[model samples]
Target: MQKNSSSIKSSTDILKQAIQFIGQHNITAIPINYTVSYEYCRGHHVLLRQAIDQAIVNKQPITNEAIQGWFDAFLLGYDLSELNKSHLDLNNIVDQLASTTTQAEEDVNQYDTSLKECKDELNETLDTSSLSSIVSSLLTSTTAMQIAMEQMKQQITASQCEIASLQDRLALVTIEAVTDPLTGLANRKGLSMAINESLSTALQSKNYPCLLLLDIDYFKKINDSFGHLVGDKAIKILADTLKKQLKGKDTAARYGGEEFAILLPETDLQNAWKVGENIRRVVESLRITRSNNHEEVFRMTISIGIARYQANQSINDLIELADNALYQSKNTGRNRVTIFETKL
Candidate 1:
């Protein structure tokens, strides 16, 4: 009991320190669970600790973007461990079910053999004691068989319930796996999945898909000027703008840092360019105010690059083209959209 109490106190102390560390760095992304879990984790804990330390050493406020970058690099798929544990449990249940089935089969075979023996004994001799003994043996065998079957049925039902539970957990884990926790937009992995599905639909319908790459113009300046909290708000504002502009089948994802991506299904280059222009204009229209003073702080803008998918083209190739076009927008001027021109 004393040992357990000491361990709990130690864990509590570590969690408190972790929370203080997050506070010292001005990080809003560190959830309570993450802080608590970091107390127990080794590799990921060290990674995050080093990142926070570096930010402190550099006198940089730990922005959500920095945390997200670390997550993408060091902790991308760590959240799925629980899901994996669920799967392992499900496998174990299945194995138990199989074992129960084997036991039931053996019981059935034993009952069958006992019944045949009783029939043979009754036919050979009609003595009262022998007949009584055979009848008792038959009744015992039947009862044992029934019990085995009942146990097997119960095991199967329990296994089914457990499997259903694991599946639900897996679905949730899948969503969290591909989603960006901060902006509620899809992450890079989710973006890739969406793009691949869109490309497949395009191939089947002969309608080309389009990709748009967007970057928040002068985002670092925003962080330096206001603070990371306001910078987070600015990023969220852009995300909201992108979400509003997307169609039913369109996918918008955070493509790391100030970069975002959109996969538009069944769209050509011209329409995609127009969509990018709309997003650019809407973002430029946003005015963020300082929370403390209620004074208008600044407006935001984004640069976008648009490219239509070609037949037999890879997602990376499409993104590269769009990325180059996005740079064109950045080079010429901010708050504009550029279409990727195909090189002959």
Candidate 2:
């Protein structure tokens, strides 16, 4: 056994119940058991198992309170922590695990910042150096002063390295801006750029893409019933499902709270319907665990609205069409798919 070997085993064993529940169900689950057992349970059962198994390999012990805390933090998807810990917090032991992850990320960021600052200061020093500046100005007069020519060449080479360092830092910042801090997935801005580009291509090629808009049903009710903590688990489960169904030329966006949108490129109404039906089935079939310490399974029914792209309109038009269709699904009785048509 290794460091947290026993604890990790306990975690894996706990997830076993969740895995069994997912296996028994033909579809995926919502409000997934995002505790220790399902650490990486988003996306699918295969993912859930892999996450738990890796944690077990690390041999870490996870307390029940820590297990509960993980759900509160990760699945609940809260952007800001009240930085609050309760007096009866049953999760203090797992605090080390989360802190470790946070510290690692913080360290990497600090390193990058320090490295860039060092390079910037170096450049400033070189720029202000009388020797380098004079050498450059007098380079054309090199024959008049060969010594000066050689020194300028060296300064230029040194400056090139400093500039390269700056360029690298700029790239890192750009990537960080478009990434989801937790999941490492594209953020709303990145998703928007991608969708816009895809729409343009579809219009130019005279091919249509399907846009599906969906929201968790009675989400507010769930939150009110079982605290915001458990409500977060439900959101993560849905996010996982969206990720699983995504493919090349397909994009999924958070589309605001409890709501998600997907864009499928060069996919027509029939194929889009097939895809929509698949999503509907997967969501309805997801077996999610609830707030009770005991096993509680849940299935979510999604109301989806689909819209096709037209050269005459903008991306917003497509989104609105999909929303209308989704509204129709909800009206007809939630947990179904509706396609948009100008007629209604």
Candidate 3:
């Protein structure tokens, strides 16, 4: 469909036809700048005139269908400038005129010379009834109507662009409200919301959700051994890696300094265990590098503890249970996944 389209070429033709078509209607006293005859086409004028002339050059016998096809073709082309709707409207008129003229030509085929003569009269206002009635009537009756519709279309297009721009702005606004800038993860506020929503849904559906609280083990030593810059990079890398592992519905957050959390909705103890193991394996496999005079690599892992919501427990109680399990993971070996064991 896009094969024959060239934006400039199509628009130029549409404008050419409009000027010629309008002149034939005798609706206006304006001069065509009718010089080299062909040269009227070469100059820059109102876009509608150009569009009409372009159709004429194709030399297809003007018929109603043919005229419609021409206008439809011109419309298929991209709008060159916002101000060109007038030109577009002009193109439409030319297409209509051409169609009517083709009908006139066929009816008066016996006057072969008359069709040629009418075509010329179409070039400018001359004494031809078909060209005058069919071509010119289209011009006089609908001038106000076409102008109004074109203006409305342009307004609609402008409004759509504004809507899209505002939507993008809104998304950025939303991100700033709930995201941790440094780690590109959810902030405390965002994480709290996730916990509440997850718990609420679980109570309604009776499907327990698991929360995993995670913290980097011996994170302070890296700050001491490498420097704060490397420490920050380590945090960012881990955040990015963990985020990649999480599903769209799951939440990963920079809960606080050197700490992160994941909220897994609709998940139970068994599923949470698999997710924890995957996180553990992925964290163990990271190869972080620091820029020294040459290069130095830094590596570490996370201690994660998973806790499932009890049927009647509060969201805060659920968070604390996960936190305690995370502490146990850190205390036992520093790099492992542990599930909270509630007091019987």
Best by lDDT: 1
lDDT of 3 at 20: 64
Which 10 consecutive residues of model 2 have the lowest summed lDDT?
81-90
Q: Number of clashes in every candidate structure?
A: 0, 12, 22
For residues 170-262, what per-residue lDDT tens digits would candidate 3 score against the true structure?
A: 345455546887998998878887878877777888998899999888899989987788888888988998888999689999989899999
lDDT, model 3, position 343:
83
Quality of model 2 by C-alpha lDDT:
0.62
C-alpha RMSD (angstroms) for model 3: 22.0
Lowest lDDT 10-residue stretch of candidate 1? 35-44
User: In candidate 2, how many Å is residue 126 off?
Assistant: 42
Regions of model 3 farther than 4 Å from truth? 1-166, 291-294
Q: For residue 155, give model 2's deviation from the true position in Å.
A: 5.1
TM-score of each model, in listed order? 0.67, 0.52, 0.51
Could you tell me how far off, in angstroms, the CA of residue 86 lies in candidate 3 after the best superposition? 37
- Give the number of the best model, judged by TM-score: 1
Query: Which 10 consecutive residues of model 3 have the lowest summed lDDT?
Result: 29-38
Model 2 regions lying over 4 Å from their true place: 1-169, 182-185, 290-294
